[model samples]
Target: MSTQPPSAPVAEPPPAGWEEARSRVYAVGLAAALPSTPRPLAEADGHTLAEPLTTRTDLPAFPTSSVDGWAVRGEQPWRVVGRVLAGSTPAPLTSDGTTVEIATGAMVPEGTTAIVRIEHSARDPEGLVTGVPRPRPEWRLPGEEARAGEELVASGTPVDPALIGLAASCGQDTLQVRRPPRAALLVFGDELLTSGPPADGRVRDSLGPSVPSWLRRYGCQVRAADVVGPVADTLPAHVAALRSALGTADLVCTTGGTMHGPVDHLHPALEALGADHVVNTVAVRPGFPMLLARVTSDDGRVRFVAGLPGNPQSAVVALVSLVAPLLAGLQGRQLPVLPQVTLAEPVPGRGDYTHLALVRLDRATGTAYPVRHVGSAMLRGLAGADGFAVIPPGTSGSVGDRVRVVPLPLLPGERTW
Candidate 1:
């Protein structure tokens, strides 16, 4: 009796170029961006503006004093007539040789010729003021910063503290912004320990605790309760976890089980859910096995799933490469731009594959230097790195070469030039 051998596994398509993979995932996210809503200025931080921010009134609705000074009419040595403080309107300097003591940010009186700074003015016993007016105007005229109803910020701009302050200055009590995308994290790997160091071939799960913070930096709403981990390495378990996460999250990020190993069930589970592949793999070293898929839920809502590598550093690479752009698109923001940095040392390329080398940046010199312990599975180098120096395929990075650098997101209260 002739026995037929088991059918061979189907081969996946060739990996996509790094740039192409990122672009594809971004397109998918842009097509499914969240709806816009009105949020108060206090709640609008970390969201993208859904419409241009226009000024309700002329910036500095009236002429405003730039410093504590005397607003004089006609000429200097004027008689001091009145005082103006912030939020108070003063009578116009209707008479020549008349002046008003104006506080900084107070509205300048109408018909004022110029302002003499308080420090530069002298008051006589008769209460008259004498000073030389500087060449530049000491007070800002109405509409100096922006005209009434003029667009000050464009749509799709991410809201930050400065932007919020500007919006408030423009008389906006609430901003129209796109809601932050909700995300869920599911870490797949039976050999991962939740609360311990590596032992008996099981490594501690670092991505589960760290990825949520990274997602938050991208303006994603990832609550602690949304993170599920150490799922059993079975097809049923993978399918169930993904379904539950996808039911509520706009995007679900899964770590490990991307490859077609005997225990890897991610691909089979994705297929069973009828998910469409947006990107299967990328041509970047250390994170080449990354994938992105578009899944449609039973209620007709579309969601995304990003498959990150099992290695600690490789997973981070995948995040910066794929997830950053995708999040920007989902918020209706412009595509992320890579900053350029000069290399301090020579970096070897990966031949046909793109090389993403972890590097510490010398901001003083704008130079990038390779860091230590940057192996795919290690996190020590990543902890010290400022960004990744992207060496394109078929090219090695030479010292002093200006190359594109993908920066890590700054944590709260961190500033970058």
Candidate 2:
């Protein structure tokens, strides 16, 4: 079994409720880092743009046929004289009695006032229409969807594959986006180990592996994952180590040290380093002890540090609440959108605390129901959960109450329904 020092002290009990802790964290935080440079449009998914993208060409780029029909002259039906395909831009239509057979997406020659469907024309043995055409609107005008040089995408927009397609359609091959922040993760605990079967009194290190996934989800680059065992005992030394890590990192995350346990020296260490808590707690359950600290050395350099509870579920919650926001702010990106739904039952009571319950949101019915195995210590609740139902602070509603839910970080290679 892992051993604690004989002089190791006992920790203070966790604070009574969520609000006290959350307020502590928010009051002491800094923005997250933003991505830089234009990623090749090929790999820009999930990145936020740093600049607005203007269209180089109108959506159609020219007057185009919206249907496979005959482009005709003003007010009068005419005989088919020629054919126009999508790529060829023939000279403008000048004849009043003649029509050009045009395919869908083909450019309409000038002077054509309307399009007559091929079915409406009287076709001869020569594959040409020889009769008057039905009256209709002219070809679709250029710039109907987007004018040339109009803004096709705004800055700070998250770029997905579809957005990339839009950029390409607007004649752009690359896009400017905030750069992902670089992070250093420190997992601190006496009983933690990198790899090995857990002994009777020890647990395997979880945050080291789990946090990287969360970091990547927010477009962060985890540069180092250092598993620092509970060997740190003094405030000064812990602060120095964190400072060193911060020197090379945009953000630092420490797991298992936010609580006031006797051996939990992280809070004092942060104070010594000129760090103040932004939010010490949130009114959210399952993540009460989450702490956000903004550490700025005397000379004015700032670093963001997050302290997460040791429990796996608590740690994940803290990441979502504290780290995720910091990451988005640093990159100058907006927070992920939370999906909304109607709840199936009343959460036990109404209070100043926001309850985060593991839940399944049925896409088909727009109903949300709490999932099983949800205590802060239970990993199973997090595993099978699609997301969490966020009951706001101080609000109570019966079944069918409307609640918002922040989606869980999706796993890699998971198919999107």
Candidate 3:
């Protein structure tokens, strides 16, 4: 059976609301360490560009046929002299009463006035063309979508598949994007097993497989080399893991050991390392023991460490509170904007702390309903949840009350719908 260890000397309870706790970390400016670098376009998806995308060639470099049709000079009832398919050279039509058969995307024949749709044209026994052309030109003129040297997309744009396609259309093979912030994980718990199911009073380590997935979703690059293990519950082991992770990681995440339990060594270990706290404990339910700190590497590079609680659900909540915004800023991505939704039923908040409830969303109606089995140690609730619904300190929200919902990990500029 699990036991509650002696309480850590409670620091004065954090300012009484979730915003105050999050604002404290936001004020520290944690984004300076991540840098920008030129990256190949193929591999740069999800990165924010550090420079504008300038076109190397005019969009539709040649006059392009928008429809498969006959390229006519002026009048119909003309002779079909040649045929032009996409990528094929077309015989120039220089005189009136002459036409050339053309396929979609084929370059327009020189001196051609417009395209007559194949459905609107007919060939007589003598190979004479007869049709009334559409009023508008059915060909895209060069530079219609973009001109060479034009700025197609501004700097700081997030690169998605569509943006990548845009860059490729503009003749770019590569782009400059902010380098992904590198993070390392250190899961701390002597009772956690690396493999197999929970048995004999030891549980499986969930953070190793789960937390890194979250980090990657938020645009962080978690290298496999830096993931240390379920270190033994000892100060020396904790300190050793901390120092080793600080050596190469911009951010090191330590799971468990934030409290004052006999086995909890993160607080004392961090103190021994002269680390400064960014957020010691937040005034939030289920994950209040979460901690963020700044520590300098032996080589003088500044690094960060976040201590997550032992409970599986609480640890993930802490991650959403601390790491999500921090990584967004560090990766040069915009802070995520929380979506507001109506509650499907009444939910109460903790008297001294804010409550976050995992919820399922009816996106079509913009309403949130609480999920079941949501204790700190339980992961079942989160597995079926869409996002967290914020219930502020000292207040309750009834059905139809508007509340802010923090979305699960999303790509930049992606809409919840």
- Pick the TM-score winner: 1
Model 1: which residue pairs collide?
A: none
Q: Tens digit of lDDT per residue, candidate 1, span 1-417? A: 759988999787999999898898888888988889999999999889999999999998998999998999987679988899999988888999999899999988888989999899999998889998898999988898999999999999989899999999999999999998999999999999999678999889999999999999888999888999889999999999999999889999999998999989998999998999999989999899999989986777889999999998989999998999998889998887888999999999999999999999999999999999999999999999998999999999999999999899876346563
Pick by TM-score: 1 or 2, better one: 1
Cα lDDT tens digits, model 3, 1-417, are 659887898566453346765655544534453567888889998787778989998888989999998999877688888889998877788899888889999999899987899999889999999988888889999999989999988776678899999998888889988877678999998899999999999999888888888888777778887778888889999998898888777788889999888899998999988999888888888798998898865666777898888898899888888887677666655566778999998777877788888989998898999999999999999999988888888887789999998778765566774
Query: What digit string (tens of lDDT, one per residue) describes model 2 on residues 34-89?
Result: 43787898887767788898888897688888778788775444666788999998
Give all TM-scores, in the order shown: 0.94, 0.79, 0.87
Rank candidates by TM-score, best first.
1, 3, 2
Question: Residue 223 of model 3: what lDDT?
Answer: 81
Candidate 3 residue spans exceeding 4 A from truth: 1-17, 20-30, 81-93, 146-154, 223-225, 298-300, 410-417
Q: Give the lDDT ranking, best first.
A: 1, 3, 2
Show the lowest summed lDDT stretch of 10 residues, model 3.
24-33
User: CA lDDT of 394 in candidate 1?
Assistant: 100
Give model 1's TM-score versus the native structure.
Answer: 0.94
